[model samples]
Target chain A: MSEHGERSAPGKGLVNGLAVTLKTMTRRSTTQQYPDVQPELPPRSRGVIALLEENCTVCMLCARECPDWCIYIDSHKEEVVVPGAARARQRNVLDRFDIDFSLCMYCGICIEVCPFDALHWSPEFEYSELDVLDLLHDKDRLGAWMPTVPPPPAHDVLGEPSKEEATAARKAAGPGAPTAARTARARPETPEPGK
Target chain B: MPLWLDLLVRVVAVVAAFLVLPLLVGQAEHKVMAHMQGRLGPMYAGAFHGWAQLVADGVKFVQKEDITPRDADRRVFQLAPVVALFPYLIVLLAIPLGPGGLVAQPLDVGLFFVLAVLGIGVVAVLMSAWASANKYSLLGGLRGAAQLLGYELPLVLAAASVAMAAGTLSLPGIVEAWSPWWLLWQAPAALVFFVSGLAEIRRPPFDMPIADSELVFGYMTEYTGLRFAFFLLAEYVGIIVIAALTTVLFLGGWHGPAAEHLGWLWTLLKVFAVSFVIIWLRVSYPRLREDQLQRLCWLVLVPVALAQLVLTAAVKVAL
Candidate 1:
């Protein structure tokens, strides 16, 4: 913001400005019709938290680790008789799972802390509610958002296989496959170039 | 044609043009300004490129609640919008769309009539500013007065140069005497007139009085609903008036090829073309600071306009 700048010609800046606007007038306008046309969000963009109800094992890790204290979980013990033994085994059955979206800070701590792959980010954000209470997504409502969760983006070309992919590959190789500890010791650590 | 019937038809046509053309310019401003800034402006009003956006706006303005401040002067405050708007209608009547007595009223001193009537618009600004009982409104009104004082000289002087060149004060007479070469001859006065006209109307870059960020719409701060709509309508009419005046005086109104048969069409085409430039200017420039605005008027526009007047005189004397 110079008050006065050296100019070779008077009104040159004014002419330049007019030329710029005229050029812009001929260019295509960059406006998107949001309601008439759905936007193309990035792959795996964070829009809303979704739940995989079947994958949830009644673990309280997500609820406990939530920074906003927005997640709620409740469960009851269920007794199941063993097939060929007199002893009975007690297991937890999920009775309630809710996320108070109105209070949720969307910090993603709950999804990160979940022991099981029970929560995912869905790129479907048009869930506005008239009442705050309506924003408290119950298990059924959270589960509905799961379908909108996009597949994770591809890793870099030179990146290592993901943990899940690696695990699955190792399983497919059978019992005779190289063990994790054996492979680690088999690859000798190379000395630094300077050393 | 019968004289009374002919007068009646002309009046009706002028009134129709007065009502419609401003709205058309307003709509063009919306679309043009939008595209200049890389946005689609009002794409859904008429369902096809927002042709009826201003019409829809008029309906919306009708539905709004009109409010009068408790401390305001009730009568004058209520009357301000009409005062602002009515003069342009009078000015429009004197403007000729073509040759052969195509004007609504055809005043003998049409240039004087137009300039005089255009001056009355600022009175409405003063009335609204004084009556609104608001500080911002008062500041805006005072600024409008100052702007008028500064710009009016150049505006009139530039127009006077053209009137001298044509050797007539009537708008149609000016057009009838116009030659294509006057485009170059009258170029300086044309620039001065157009710039001053823009300032007089308080269009952007000269919109210090109603600098929305500072004055909250200036003299129109307290206006709402249909009254406010009238002010908006007046602003658009001002643009049309200025553009038409510029066209008539400098651009050779209704003087294109085949102008005898298609004279009104040429006039309208020129008017819209000038209006587009007005909108283009608004999109291009930021509002000038108050001091800078005055400086441009007093230092630049006035001197150039005076030089142009002398040139016009010298050319007239030699001829």
Candidate 2:
């Protein structure tokens, strides 16, 4: 009954409303000045595709797997004498790597399928062109976005290093080096199959 | 003063009112309302605080395509904005800027003329809506008619109560009748006038006719280019006139210490002050439901206005 009576107080609601608006009117405004001030994007946000040329072995996996058939790759075999062996060897040297952005749907299948870790998602998505054909970015342009692809998020201090990093580190350290610390830290937390 | 000169002055005043006041009022509304809602409003287009935004907007409106729907009544659709805007511009002729014959004409029946001309805009709204042949526009037209029916009585009654107290139909006469405490004397009528006038102009809280969420720009939906600009201009003009009328009746026209010297300035200040409050009210209140709005006008405003009218007449006669 008291609550109902409060709601019925004639013009009280309107007065209260005016008071609220008046209070807000005096407070500092919260308008963002866009364009003039570029927004701070997250480091991990997927923006554009970047290519690491060194890691690419012309495996044709990204091109073969692309749903859009947008990734066009060309390569030629090069023969070279082995440094220690008595025989000559042939290797696929990359000739051309072009991603037709007009057709490349940015589905990230190319990035996911690169077995040699040859592709990355770069946070540099501001390449617009007047002509559609101009969007067919070649290897050099794709590689230009590589420097902007932020280094992978820092490894947590107390956590075990990733398998790739650990294996690479072990290889660099030598074959017989004991990976005892990593095993000790990880094995206890590993859940058994039934449990 | 020569007759031609007087005519020129009046024309200039009316024209200036149309051109200048709209821009000033538009800017003030945008800036003030933005502050009220915790926004920086317009920050570009004028070197500082978007002062030239209205000019840019005018240019944009002019350049836009004048689209006429294939099914629309071409003549009425074309004529609606001209009809809506000109009468309100003429209505300003009666409103006094300063004491001692500073108004455009200041007719003996000025209030009567103002009220009659005020109804023309609503007619234009309905005409444009009906002419559009759109279902939503038809609903908007119906809503406008319903609002006119619900609120017109209180609007007339509120103004009439003031006329009764003043013993004249002229706005300048009402100003003369006031004893500087006109607000206290005619407080109830003023309240009715403000609320009913909001309904009359189809402003927020009473803007069911232009309910954007449901009706998609309402009666002016199909209008484009300059025609749309005209409707927008008419709304701002409507707000100015209502504020000026309220000033004359309740706030005592140009009744301040410097009125003789700076009377027109005081009038401008008071008019904008009233407009500021209206904009504030717009931001503060949510749109009233159709049923709720009708109930307010009929159940509350009409009864109060009626009582105030009777009370004012009796007091006038007794005194």
Candidate 3:
């Protein structure tokens, strides 16, 4: 008996098998023409690690938190003059930064724990090399990949405004902040009751 | 006017049909199957859609080390490929390519000759399988022998229906006898022939002999380099033979309008059309299991072909 009770047929499976193949044979292929065309990657896809050089304070936080110990950082204390304050202030100046990608587990922990948004996951991962040693990317190479890192996704409209956005909005609302006030007007954020 | 020159010319033509044409057919198979599957097959070698890819592959195969098994029957292993390839070209010699019976030999019993010569390749396959001395190879050979034996019956019976309908056994003569189309008159027999012929060639829907997943490439497991290349070539050439025979028998070989002038071209078109259908079957159907293969041949095709035979005879007598 048929599933619907109208009619049952022998060898319907065979006909359906052929029909499926015929349908697939006519459908457009889902092949990605890689190398010639860039694939559409999600904004925060973890492909390769990148560094924002200016934001990296040589704090050694990324290196300490890294499970693989892939991140190596060096810095020297540089004295800077502070006008109308103490005679000189000493701050760590970044000297050398290297990421041995050969050892990188790519767990995104380094990017997560970074207090300063210095590390980002750039979705530009076509860095295959003949030699394993060539994969140990230095500061300049890591910094170069930062430009390829896509901007973070837009925040949820219905959700509470983020801390960064809320603080920036507060700054714009304060008197004498003119330039940021223009950006603040563009983004209409609902007032958080607690704030 | 010399007989030896006539023989030499015919030999060259056979060589051209089997050896030269298969390269183009192989290219077409790759390109067509790729398109059907929604991908570009070859884009590099010749720069304009990989025309030289086969040539490059041939060069690569030629360069590989010809490995032989430690305890193999060295002589049989060496000669099996030659056995596989040699006879089918002779079968091609007997087939008509155009109207007005445009064949090299056009012998009185050409149909029988073609079928007989085509069957010789099975021995080569068996020889390779047995010679390899591998258990898998032996199983593959056994499967091949059974498959070839099973399918050949229905194949011949299907052809018998065509012969009974047309009242002739010579291939070109059958073409001359066909009025509208052999396919219309002997549709069931044609189906039986096509399905059975696919089995004969050990192609998909019946390729239990070389079930790669199960038998590790079956009879060809131990072959390497040029020997393996020969077996591959033999299979493709067997496809050509099947296509040509189908064209001659069922499609009314070169019987198109203006076929006298464009007969060879029509023959080519029909042959390739049959080949395309075979490829279509390959893409659509999964390989039949060994038991399924046997059941299909014995229970289904053989009985159907016999019925079709009786029907054709009845129709012939009624007419």
RMSD of each: 4.1, 5.4, 4.6
What digit string (tens of lDDT, one per residue) describes model 1 on residues B47-162? 99989899999999999999999999999999999999999999999989987887888877999989999999789989999999999999999999999888999999999999
lDDT for each of the candidates?
A: 0.90, 0.87, 0.85
**At residue B177, what lDDT does model 3 achieve?**
89
**Candidate 1 lDDT, tens digit per residue, A51-126?**
9998898879998988888989999999999999788999888889999989988888888888888999998989
The parts of candidate 2 lying over 4 Å away from their true place are A1-36, A59-70, A82-85, A88-92, A102-117, A150-195, B27-50, B60-79, B126-138, B164-169, B176-185, B212-225, B283-286, B310-319
TM-score list, all predictions? 0.90, 0.78, 0.89
Q: Which residue pairs show backbone clashes in model 3?
A: none
Docking class of 3: acceptable
CAPRI quality of model 1: medium
Candidate order by lDDT, decreasing, is 1, 2, 3
Question: In terms of lDDT, which candidate is strongest?
Answer: 1
lDDT tens readout by residue for model 2, B226-252: 999999898888889889999988888
lDDT of 3 by residue, B46-82 (tens): 9888999888888878999998898899999889989
By TM-score, the candidates rank as: 1, 3, 2
For TM-score, candidate 2 versus 3, the one ahead is 3
* CAPRI grade, predicted model 2: medium
Record all residue pairs in model 1 with backbone atoms less than 3 Å apart, i.e. clashing.
Answer: none
Window of ten residues with lowest summed lDDT in model 1 chain A? A186-195
lDDT, candidate 2, at A62: 96
Stretches of model 3 off by over 4 angstroms after superposition? A1-8, A36-40, A151-160, A167-195, B1-4
Q: After superposition, how far is residue B157 of candidate 2 from its true place, in Å?
A: 1.9
